[model samples]
Target: MADKEVQNSKKPPSKSVSVVNKTSSVSEDTPKTVPNKGPQVLCLRILNSLNENMKSQKERFEKLESAQYYD
Candidate 1:
């Protein structure tokens, strides 16, 4: 039959199924990555220092402004 002939002309989907199975097994055997937290903690400390510096600078500028207006 023409339908049988068409089916025979196309390659089967079995290879894709085997590929998926292979990837699943490989992923199971692979080790997952552990993230480094040291740098992250250091970065947080640096950001906090920068924020404190900015707050102090803002307070100093406000004091100067008030002093100028009072003179």
Candidate 2:
């Protein structure tokens, strides 16, 4: 009876180890299945272009204001 109990205890540890291995493997695969970054990249590009346009507009406005002051 003592031997049977020892064997059962050993079996549970092995099962727990296998479960841990499976969870680790699943976690490793998660990054590979990540959503595509295409939309995020496109949005960043658009925001950058808008920022550039805003800067140019501000420069033009400043130039016009200075010209009016000099007139």
Best by TM-score: 2
Candidate 1 has its poorest 10 consecutive residues by lDDT at 23-32
Q: Scored by CA lDDT, what does every candidate get?
A: 0.65, 0.64
TM-score of 1: 0.48
Can you give the lDDT of residue 65 in candidate 1?
Answer: 100
Q: Highest lDDT, which number?
A: 1
Clashes of each: 0, 0
Off by over 4 Å in 1: 1-36
Model 2: per-residue lDDT, tens digit, 1-71? 99998888876444333334432112223233335689876665566666667778999999999999999
14 in model 1: Cα distance from truth in Å? 34
Residue 6 displacement (Å), model 1: 23
How much does each candidate deviate from the true structure in C-alpha RMSD?
Answer: 16.4, 15.4
Per-model TM-score on C-alpha atoms: 0.48, 0.49
